[model samples]
Target: MSNGWNHTAKIESLSFECGFCNNKVASDIGFFNNNNIDGLRARIRICPHCSKPTFFLGSKKLPDISPGNDVKSVPEEVHALYQEARNCISISAYTASVLISRKLLMNIAVSQGAKENLRFIEYVDFLAENGFVPPNGRGWVDHIRKKGNEATHEISLMDRDDATELVTFSEMLLKFIFEFPASVPALPSA
Candidate 1:
């Protein structure tokens, strides 16, 4: 009944198609749990048509939920970068998102003691080398980074196309970080 994630569900107000029955059914049963280390887990019965089972687990945490494992599972710097990248995209600030993505990539590189030089192409290359991004994504990263540079320097205006691209890149970066946090090495001393 409890998996450790906070959730609120009203059984009477819930209705969904049953996956198993392939028919509409009222959601009469609700289960909610708040997972402290991760996020929320909820299970609800929608219809007899689909009266199977539903599970939802929010957030990813270290295996076993141990404090030390959790700490070692995801670096704070990487999480911060993810948050900033998400914020920039949510606000439709594509240029800002691109810049922040660059910073995140750079931070990962520096943490691994890799090259610290700041260049669009180099940034993509570093991301690829560190396995934080797909090898073919280099071109896309370079494109966004260049676009961000022009906008930041006032050489070009932030356009919808650029903004959309930046958002996509941010999303991809966030997914990568979530899947492979260890790939982002620790940052070097400033």
Candidate 2:
């Protein structure tokens, strides 16, 4: 079949988790090329669910579309918000990702016993003052608040870098507050 690359090769099909639609799909080969001498291969597959294309060099997908690593031992509600923020980045929804990252901080604070209904900045302060925000991480955590405010109050769009930073900081914060604490063995009974 003819493609934009003007290459002729047998069409192939493969099953993968579609990054665009987040579905397991059997996709048709949209394009393919191989260099036998060096064993390099490039391919594009059309996701049946989203009708979008995923590019692969050899077996690795380009622009990795997976969300950030899951934080162990997070509260169920907090984990959901974290996943939402991470998923937004996977789909290039940077603004939504940043917004969700902001919310995730509040959720984390509340789950860790901070009172709800306080001002947004208060939630950040709660995290910082209570030792949830890592040492030297105040700057990074504050960046999320500032970026989130800009995305919320101003006429501007959050970009991929902004979203990635916010989400990554959130991941580290979650690990510090929930996962690491959960891993510590309990002291022997007094």
TM-score of each model, paired residue for residue: 0.45, 0.71
In angstroms, the error of model 2 at 100 is 0.4
- Residues 1-190, candidate 2, lDDT per residue (tens digit)? 3333425334677888877677888866476764421375677787778888787767766434656687899999999999889888776688999999999989998998999899999998998999888789989878989999999999999988999888888888888989999999999999
Instruction: Identify the leading candidate in terms of lDDT.
Output: 2
Q: Backbone collision count in every prediction?
A: 12, 0
Error of 2 at 128 (Å): 1.0
Model 1 bad stretches (over 4 Å)? 1-74, 117-121, 177-190
Error of 1 at 104 (Å): 2.2
Stretches > 4 Å off in candidate 2: 1-64
